[model samples]
Target: MNAPEFKKLPGVLAFQRGLVITDALFFNVLKDSQTPVMVVRHGIRGTQNVNKDGDAEKSTAANAKRQEVSNIQTTDTAKLEEEAQALAVRFGLRFLDLKDVLFACAPASTDANDLVRNYRDSVTGFIERAKTSPGLDEVAQRFARNIANGRWLWRNRTIARQVEVHVSVNGTPLASFDALATPLNHFDNITDAERQVAAYIADGLRGDDDAGLDIEARLDFGVRGALEVFPSQNYVEDKPRGFARPLYCLGSPERAGSRNGIEFESTRTMGHAALRDQKIGNALRTIDTWYPSYAEHGRPLPVEPNGASLEAQEFFRDRKTSAFEFARRLNTLDPASPEGMFMIASLIRGGVFSGGKE
Candidate 1:
């Protein structure tokens, strides 16, 4: 008789992200005072240039035709006050118990029940393995180093003359670091104090305490004078005609103005230029140097199941290194290995991975 067909993965499986990051709010710092940096509107005359999708002659003809029409419009701009000497970005970080990582799992058939059970058992085993292995510790250190290096500051980090990062837990100061001194390209050369910070975060991830972790990070940029600060940009599909650029701000939504019969809402009431929690989280998890092409890439990408780098427009991992494949063969993987650590890290990062076999 033929052997029974092997069951596929569960039809519905999902895991919530273990790491919790709050939105980073922007502030203009002057001595002992802090004020919200407001995003204001700026009107300017700009040249119109539209490139066509064909050969050079076709593109040149299209551009020349579009140049006949004026494209001057208003844009959004954010900057520190003239007296402000620095920019301060503050955000909160928290981690959930990895032991309770599974958010959902629904079996479509009796045969699939075995697959579900195996996955659940694997999660428990992996957690125990992580406790004994250095997998969790290494991942935690990379995150901590990212925080200490002020990598989340993005473009602001390049403009700053000096950068200072402060970490606090539950309103109590834990440690502060000179963000500039920390290397941005690698995680191996971290200082002793940074290691201590990583230990605290690792303990929280391991579910060592029930009090729950409430960590906050503040990055202070010494710019010496007023300068333009970068904030998350809003992706508006149907933006108003003249309003070409809209920045993300923390505030109540209200009608800011209208251009060419289109009305747009403004988030400038609260007057805080800020970065989204998603952006900050992405920066913190930029520790995926285990991808097959890391030797050629040199820099690390964010910890993603598919090794997706949106900025670079590339997928660095194949099916063998993907989270789905790792989960399928969890029993065979050593938690201390790079692939094993990557899978665990992806669990912490979290997302739905339901097989659509139903």
Candidate 2:
């Protein structure tokens, strides 16, 4: 029989995210009670901008006429209450089976469908090999390190004097980590607790169990004063004057117009300050040390198809290192290699990767 002819990828190909994360809810811990931290609107006075260019007399006059203006700012701020010692953030994580990674794949034509059918076994073999590979295990280890290090806390982690992370599998308590003591910049060294967590995560990825992991992280500022904590900020296209920043919050529909209610993304709410699931997932998957510039940059970026870093304003990967290129050569790559691991990790990260023709 003639070999199957395949020159291009399927027109519609996508993978479901393997590492599923839930939105993290924030709570203000006060003595024996835990309450949801609500977003509040603050009204403050600020001086207006004064033109200081051109004529000196005009500049002086403009400065003199500049008046104090009332500015209303709406944001979500979490703090340890006067009687509280810590702020708690709770979220859940689910690791999907890599064996069932593909979410969608629609071939453009009958020939293409035949080609994919012929190539399916090769792809399956690669995935099966990856399951037992050390490279994949390393990826899982990095993910666990992020959890143990409290990287998901984002800005809140910076202000925390002490952080404790509690993890559980299903409902059973597994391990706790001293998040403050764990380094965030590198994953070269991992404590025994981090390794334990990584084993569970690796098992989950390999489809050893279906039950997910639950996590709760507490940040202690070591002070009774209200120290501001950061929550995920919402993106508003048409922000009103003085309302440039908006924080994310969750509330019930029944509380929409109630006296204790506030806007979902704006206004003072009886809701809770929380981080988005996307943000949480991004933190968990910041394990792309395989990127070319990672050695020079000294930081791991989130696994992306292009090794893109929005903050750095650069794409670290060229065509050779891109996910598309890796996918193209998946059948030939050694599943235990770093490049192969990164390709599989990208699939776990999940996205539309249809390369229509050529």
Candidate 3:
């Protein structure tokens, strides 16, 4: 019998344990793919208290200090880890210990977004170190180039080398199929104007349609004229009835170059369909979660009618997926998603404060 194809995806999309991702957007991916959620957690790192750098044997006191610095309740951490492991086992996904992939080359930093920063740095570092391995050097080189050009700086890109497909029915795991996964840049070669157009659409923004044209003829002409070259790929064009494909279809690189990559197209397409089915409210909900400050305004930025304090509102907002997921999906094309507007507001605010105090 032929071995099952594994998914080598760019990244695993896990539900942040405490955050409430919109039911519409969150369930959309789940409803479509029907894949088991792969929970992730990082390992302990040493600070002044411990020497986790090398294989040096530290004193008992150091170990105690490291545990103390973890700031995590052992009972809670162990329970969470146990639950995640159990889920993997129940779903029949090989228990993948990703500590090596996460921290093998992480740099110590004091940034507020340290986990994300370290993850990016570690992935790049791992790619560099794994250059001698087959089929990795080229990927590393391309990734480095993309980063230098800020291709993924605004978006969430994934990197998965090992993946398994488990068939589930009614949310119950049934059968497991092995697969491989990897990173792909679907829109790296698109012109800037085209990207901008996709960005606008993905942000749930609409413009006056002209006859059969989606955006105004003048705006469309301006964008096309600036491009100098038109994309001939059928996938790049709008579908019949004048709607564009969801970002997932156009953003994934066509050439994953692996046997599993071939399977990815179908899976990705299904995911796109799921996302496309989501209502615009999903995106609005995410935006609302991210920028509660705008709540003072109405309609465009809805705040609860309750007379909640600013700090209370913020605390509640932070519990939503907007806190982390937006930063991950910031640059990706999701024509129906709201990250574009949120990111734009953030950028504009940053610029406004660049020359002065907030």
Candidate 4:
């Protein structure tokens, strides 16, 4: 697997997954999955007046935006700033921070509170739209980054040999460690045949003799489903740079809100199918090594006393399990009773079910 020729190549191949449902305001352009539009919210919404310069005095536009941005009453500007950033990150959106543009868009009044609040509310509403909208809107941004960076990486590689990997995601892009990016519930409701195919996917990833097939891939998708054990939610980070979750989902749009990270590792890849297959191995092992270490930084497991219960077993299994094995165990858990089915469904929801149901 250590072929120096294939160590690193150039250029990223990204198969973009667009939003299933566009945001409320941008619905006109975003409704059709095939049709994508760069949603331009109130022009001032993204325009930012601040740069690294400290000496640029405000022109009428700058002064108006400054006045407007400053007028928004908030006890904690830091918190407000963080909110603005989080919204930006969650949606993988670019916040132009055009306080100046906003001023240009409207009349400059000494009282900017009402106008600022209106902008804030607009941003807040966009955040809400991101939480539930089917993915696609945000992944476009990721693809943009990948395309731009991959080209650069390709041009600057150490090897004369070049490689490229094309990937399409099926879930929301939350910061994730593994390829289990499909929503758990989608897997949960599937027929046994689906599980088997999924299991095959897992097996294809970690299978013996499956080595040397460089450029190969196994999708470790994220899941979306009801959380049975903790019945709780995630503690999100809100800032301009990073979010507690992944910024984009790769595959299907319906699975957007799961915010579960899943997609190709990078844009650069090799044309060699064998090389690509082997690369999938590398990606899988990397994910395997990091999932447990990174998944529970500050998060706590919800209290579930019965270790054998669906919630309890899954909590432990998912935490310590491999993507392939997790799928293998699906439906094997006695499917005779309702609890078994629920458990199986939960496993599917957990992105672990990959076996064909008999």
Candidate 5:
């Protein structure tokens, strides 16, 4: 397959396999692509602070300490601020503090943090009461669940496009990118799906025949399972952002980890079905190109000789070996034997069975 040309649509930003794309990263992409636009949606975390001159600052050490105590990962405020400012200048873009807009819609006295707390509590309360009042709580429950899980209830045939906003206190709002004065339309006023469609049309975008169908297909792929690898115990926490690895016995204690390879390029699109599926489709094709490259040069084999037993060691010898040989070797071991079971379990845990699992 040939590389897809990045569409040069002004004012409309395009993303490819961008699961971890933060606002800064998005700006960097825009800068790199040299795409010019009249406006952009800029989201920020409430914890960040900004000065009147629009210089972004990090939450104080006190703030970091607070987050640490709460078990939240600490962000490097200085680094983030500098990058944000530099990108804005380089791109000649303006910014709006989206978090402030969310709060502004609340009572004037409400604090930014308090606004988040209020929304959280309200949603939680609605869910608790949903069982007794499905009519009211059902929709609320769906909204809450979507936000909490960052997933669409597409199986339920529901499409709610609620936009969530967060801003850093030290974040400086750029004059060019600010959307506060224009005021974004509230999803509550109309179905989010409608809002998005209208925005697409307003941006001079026409509907593609398979856009929705393709999105559903990708979403289904993600829900079913999108990766061919499983991560080990040592890197359990390092599991790709959107995939989950369930524990199963493999080695003596069952060595836990993914096999197919260290990472699958497609894993990045997991959990973000709301994003354009066309971009993901392109990414999938791009990753598919790797197999031929690997086959030509000979796939690299792991050399770490450690395992629960000799059988497992052999199993890890060179996974690049033909599948027929791999299966035949497993069959030679007795199912009733502990070593046999260990080898079989190791293969299962290492994602040997995940080849066509998706």
Candidate 6:
């Protein structure tokens, strides 16, 4: 019920869907908190097209002209979506529709977007609009709180109002009372970092992790570090060892009523716990992905970045999640599962981009 109560939390952990796709990072960060994937997708805009026939099919044809949204083959997409849903069911988590969210993220660009001379403005026009919504701030807080509370759910679609329980999943990590072991069933008999690296890279490199969903990639430590963020469920293992608490425990938040804005204090009640989780799946795999990718690559940057962190690793995780899921969901006919599809849709529509990109 409170942030401090989570100091002993074992069910929370940071997570990333694919390699460093910016959108994918946002998807995992913001997934199903206050809003469903549908609302966010309302923001995605694409360019307009002119129909070849010019009159009868003008509207539909026009859409096809500028950008060709590949004709989605429902068979493959549905299969992937269903599999994710089935998996979530095993974990007691729900799945959301991706098509609705994709549409929201990929909005119809307007004349103003075309008028902008700056390239960033042209492509980012939709993203800019989406950012204006206060809904984003609200979602961030809701997501944080849900993780703090062991297993919470949004009771209403109107996330702006008072919080409710048992109504939705953005707040829930899909836990069930059972003799649950590590969902490492995807990991198998034979073991080698080589196959692990290869398989993980393949999913992260694809458009979305929704395709060829394999659990074998979940074993690495590097992937866990990168996703060392909130709602820490991804890091959790089974009872004995996985139930470590938060490294930095902050006290319950209070509004700085008389101050300029909001403020809070950190509580030193705890020392630290290993912030382990899915970063091992995507982030660590990415370090390997990059070495080979850039072995004989493009021209050197204007100047190498001087940052301490390997941003490239994080970025890889985001892209892989977004790209793989986008391709997978767009192709799905009936997405009964909520895990990847909804999160993927929200992220694509959310217009999440890696901060530093040319």
Q: List the residue pairs that clash in candidate 2.
A: none
Local distance difference test, candidate 5: 0.22
Please tell me which predicted candidate would have the highest lDDT against the true structure: 2
Query: Candidate 2, residues 11-41: lDDT per residue as tens digits?
Result: 7778889877889998888778898876654
Per-model TM values vs. the true structure: 0.86, 0.86, 0.19, 0.17, 0.15, 0.20
After TM-score superposition, the amount by which residue 145's alpha carbon in candidate 1 deviates from its true location, in angstroms, is 0.6
lDDT of each: 0.75, 0.77, 0.24, 0.22, 0.22, 0.23
Q: Please identify which of the two predictions, 2 or 4, would achieve the higher TM-score against the true structure.
A: 2
Q: How displaced is residue 344 in candidate 2, in Å?
A: 2.0
Tens digit of per-residue lDDT, candidate 5, span 1-358: 1112111111211111211111111111122342111111112233323233432245322233232222222111111111121111110111121111111122223233343334334323322332233232222222222222222211211221232222111243211211121122111243343333223212211111111110111011112111121111122554442222322111222223354576322111111012122222212111111121334433222211122122223333333333222322332334333333232222212222211111
lDDT of 3 by residue, 91-121 (tens): 1111111112222222223322344443344
lDDT of 6: 0.23
Q: Could you tell me the TM-score of candidate 5?
A: 0.15
Looking at model 5, residue 34 earns an lDDT score of 26
lDDT (10s digit) by residue, model 4, range 1-358? 1111111111111111111111111001112221111111111123334443554465323334353432221111000111111110111111111111111122133323343334334323332332232221222222222221222121112121322222222332222211122221111233332332233233222221121111111111122121111001123444323111121112222221333466422122111011121121111211111124224432222111111223224433342243233222322323333223222222212221212222
Candidate 3, residue 246: Cα displacement in angstroms equals 33
| Model 4 residue 353 CA deviation in Å | 25
lDDT of 4: 0.22
TM-score of structure candidate 4:
0.17
Clashing pairs in 1: none
